[model samples]
Target: MSSTPPVPPVVEGGPAGSAPGGSQSGHAEHKFEKWQMKKIPTMWSRTWAHRGKISFGLFLAYSGVNIYYARKQQVIRDTIPQNTILHWRITDGSIVETDTDKGYFQKILRATGGDSPSPVSSLIDVITTIKRAKDDPRIVGIMANFSTANNKTQQTKTLGLAQIQELRSAIQEFKEAKAKALGGEDKVSLIAYTDSFDNQTQYYLASAFDKVYMQPSGSIPLVGLSSTVPFFKTLLGRFGIQVRAEARREYKSMVSPFTETELPPPQKQNLFDLLKGLNSQILADIAKSRQRALGSDPVEKLNHLIQVGPFMGSEAKDEGLVDGLLYKRDCGKLVESNGAFGLAHYMRVTAKEHTNKLAKTGEPSLVVGIVYLIGGIKRGGGDFGANTVVKGIREAANDPTVDAVVLRIDSGGGDVVASDTIGDAIRWCQDEKKKPVVVSFGNTSASGGYFVSTHAKAIIAQPTTITGSIGVASLRPYFTPEFFKLIGVSVEQFFTGSSDTSLLHDLEGAALTRYKRQIDATYSDFIKRVADGRKMTIEQVENVAGGRVMNGKEALKAGLVDKLGGLSYAVRLAGDYGLEVHKNAGHLSSDMEIENIVVKVFPTPKPYLQQIVESMVGDEAVDMYVRDKIHSMIMRVWTGDMMGLLHEVGLSESSFQNAPVSERILDTLDTELNPDNSDIPDTVEVDEFDEIVSGVESVKSLEHDCDIRALCIVGYTRRKSQSNNCCMRGVEDRRLRMLFEQM
Candidate 1:
């Protein structure tokens, strides 16, 4: 330890090279340099000890600066230019409400260009964008791109007719706003372009614009509309399978497909009337839009033209269905020659300017809460998500800040109890919370959708929206022993109770009578709800409640809905009612108008982490999954995908969704045997029939109280062998568990 000698310390220098040790100048300098080098190494070593933390801190700082600059650039890019045209691309990705929540992964994915943008704008966004454009000086026009709305491959569905009408209404509003802004100059324009006008619906939407263009090779399939009902009685009879279903009234054609071999006269007439009404509306709208080109008798001319369709690009232009023929690139150049941006970009750039303006201005504002009740109204949840709608309504009603609520419905109905639960919540919201609730119908809000909204303060719908299916049907399949024998299968059952409603047993005798009584009670309850809500007599409600679907126009006349208008109109009504209530309660002055109404969506999307955690560790998640699967199966049945499956058993595919099913099946089978069709698979194995049924007898058992409204396509899957085995096992497990519980 004492092997080294002590070193002398350097003293402060009086001059450049002076040292306190009284040494030569060069020697002193060398000592000082040695000491400085030692000190520098010590400082560097201490700094290097925290290299990981230092790197991390530096990265965060760099990211902050990067984010600031990127946002600045995006703001500049999204800004509207002079005389700019906003583009609205209508595709299937369009959402009804604003999707405000984006997770960290979503943000990162978008930043890294891994996420593709939605091809279309939603209804609310589209309307809001137009409203903004109408006020902005820089925006001169809008161009709608509906090329992706309808696909020739039948892989994509067209936008709902009612949604198209809503868009049309917005466009009209935009035109009116422009005219007023220019003191009747009407300089602003709307232009529509598509690769091809694939159907009457696409062309119908295009006709709403000032000028319409299509690609040179495009064709307008403007053929007239035809509604086809698929009758399964004949096919089921061949297989010795029976379907027993009861309807509240004769007009409830939902059961006709199972009971009748062909469309009944009453249903056919009702369907014809609906078609005629819709066709008239279409002709009238087209005639009004094309008045300048059609001269006089425009509706008659349009009808004549439709009889001669489908028209090629040139033919359609000559017939005045379209204005010009041009490629998509040229069309884009023509529309956006001055400057342009997507409506989404415009919305993003201007959103900050519109956020809660009432709060900023210190003005008295009405807060309206919007709740979306979309898809089949199942008990746990619908197709929209895992959250029950009742919770959303209760939360909104209980919120002190929210003054009113608007329930936006876009469903074709589901379970009775689910609908009733939502309805009860609505009543409680109004009776207990004293908040006004308005309903806005979108596309097809019928049956259970209408049921839940029966007690709302007001109801609104688009003229083309399908609503008012108030009747109920209990449908079930009865499999005979002969059918089981044909399939080389037999099922044995032992039961002590006489109340069995299982699929393995037929619903007859006392059980069938009891089921009928339950159906009658539900129907009576439905009628009473409607009558009480509308302040109408039972006779009046019954006259319109025979399981009949009506357009908003008919619904208003029949007193089924309060008004025929879009969601915006409904929200305004809700705000007005809320303001009235405030005035009556002495909270607001009578002169205070409902200004700067703020609307918010309920049941906000959960955080990404929370969603993952809940999905991984909750019975709610499992229940939601099961309900979603059942709803999906029900949708497939109603939408005629089941008919496609039965096409394999000699049913004509043409009867299902108007496709040539028999030809497709023959072609698929021939592909295996014919060397020329080498592109297809070599064998038609069980797995090869991806969407086909393995066992038609397999059925999902619902809760005892839930009525069987329709046949659920149980065990539906895209992969036959594996999915069938898994589904069968699950069904067996559930059946055994239920049996044990019963014992």
Candidate 2:
């Protein structure tokens, strides 16, 4: 949803191709801009038909080019002046609240002195920067851009209401802090600039700033929210792929695709309630912001404009929706007093993280550990490996330096067993260790995401965050004989032990009664967890459960979430809680040097190469991360938990057609997620007949240790040595030494 526009040189003219007064042919034309390489291989490499020689030549050429560009980017970053306005354009890549950083890749790059310049930024990083900007006297203001797009689609279309809520909270926090610092004299400016606002979420984010500016020809598509749930029942019938499953309650309709063609009453109600709740929050926020923008009844103005939306730039400006109609480059002059730069560049100059780096040396510190639980929940596969997540939590909680733990969650839920396991780990961290745990919700934290967060002392969510799908489902498949015959295949069943084997097939009569009882028990447990965590009654939780999703405001009203805020608010709370821990322990005094250190929890990726071996494939599905996630759901139909499975599965389907969206989503995060780390692990076993509680143990092999260096560098070492290749440990590789005097 986000992009990283290169550090473009500021020219005197308007946007790249536009004239001073660019005219639209009704509207601007949309063009697909795929990244294209500027240069093609030729000359010496081509003459040598041998593949080995060609590969070596290309590597050398690539190395030189990479070094040159990296050095140039570094030089530019180092030269940026203080008191500069940072142009923070929004992108999906940066909008995400990832659970883990690409540590494996980070290690390799650092070791080789190579550069892995990721344009994507984690949501916490952005929030922390905004918070710091309030106190940094040298920092002037933030120009939040929503118009980062190509000729065709706006990359920020993925910026949903939840993300906007997070951004809005951060902006509000910064503004409040700045207000206090200035003693009501003046304000630190926050300007929202964009060429167009096609999405409701974008508009909501822009509304948070002091002022909003739009392109002369830009339009605002302020239409309400809608959700689509396509049923594949008819399609499956046509293909003779009979799918039979059952849900615990009426609203648990995730398996409706395999059963019903039409929307069930409960599902319809659930979907509508979620959408309407989101829309209501959006309107309310805009109304509040606009009320402040205008002295009179601007809320009425907003209500009126919303009803007659999709307004053009001139119309929006006239209606008081936007402050001005100007090009993006033109906004630079508004904030440029001393000097200015992009936030990404500024971040690099400031060591790319918020730290007390400038504090006097040897200062006492209070460390806070930040553990991200991003993406769909899974048992040792996909991005959110169960083992990996648990290991991170344990390490962070046990670390003596870390006094508090912040679990930043941006998932939409998945595997029930996996989610519960993560939840258990959170509780273990809090109860076993003295660290106070806080959970921060991202754009979408529903079902399993909510499950994992139930045990935290505090939970923070954005006003528009998708939350509270308090439900459980078991969608084990029931294959009909005729369906198997159509595929020209047959499977014979042989059973021992229990006489009651009918439950393994489909739901009917006594079997269904037993199944219902099982699901009811699981759902009850889920409700109790939420109820206990949120300090609510079982009746209250049940009233909202029924697979109903709610926005952050609705969640707060229901007492499911403690606060309506973003990751920054959660971080601050964690710091406060940490200080309280220190204070309670009698280790703190008013004058004591107490600095809060923020560290990430991403120990290592669990068992990747084994999945590759099990699948017996190379990088075939490497580009299909989203497809893999969805496909995994299809395969997991036999294991129930359908509602949870599909909660976050839709994220990948949107961009799967153009290319591997998953690969891009995990940019530089293990090099296309390493085909070895393909999802679902090797086995998903239901331990001791506990179908709702599956187990996936970590599996590591020699093949999993395979990394980029092993493939690229000719002379490499697996063991840590005093002298190594790539000029690491003050020693260069033999190949490098031969090619160049010094590496």
lDDT for each candidate structure: 0.71, 0.65
Q: In model 1, where do residues sit more than 4 Å from their true spots?
A: 1-68, 95-121, 150-157, 183-186, 356-359, 382-387, 504-511, 610-743
Weakest ten-residue segment in model 2 by summed lDDT: 689-698
Task: Report the lDDT of model 2 for residue 531.
Answer: 85
Deviation from native of the Cα of residue 360 in model 2, angstroms: 2.0
Best model per lDDT: 1
Candidate 2 lDDT for residue 100: 32
Let me know the TM-score candidate 1 reaches against the reference structure.
Answer: 0.74
Compose the digit string of candidate 1's lDDT tens values, residues 1-743.
Answer: 56877665646654444456555767789998999999988988988998899999999999999999999998789666888888877644343444432545444433453234353345666676777788888877888887755433222445677877877787887877777875673577688998887678878877888899998899988877778778889899888789889998767788899999876776677778778887888788889988887777898998888788899988888888788998888887776566888878788677766775544877767889988887788876433532357767866986789999998888989889888888888997899789999999988899988898899999999888888889898888888888889899988887787635766677878888888998999999999999999999999999888888778899999998998888878888999999899999999889988666777778655545544434455545644444444544543343454344344333343442233333333333344223494433222332223212212112212222111111112212212223233332222223222222232
Over the full model, what C-alpha lDDT does candidate 1 score relative to the true structure? 0.71
Q: Estimate each model's TM-score.
A: 0.74, 0.65
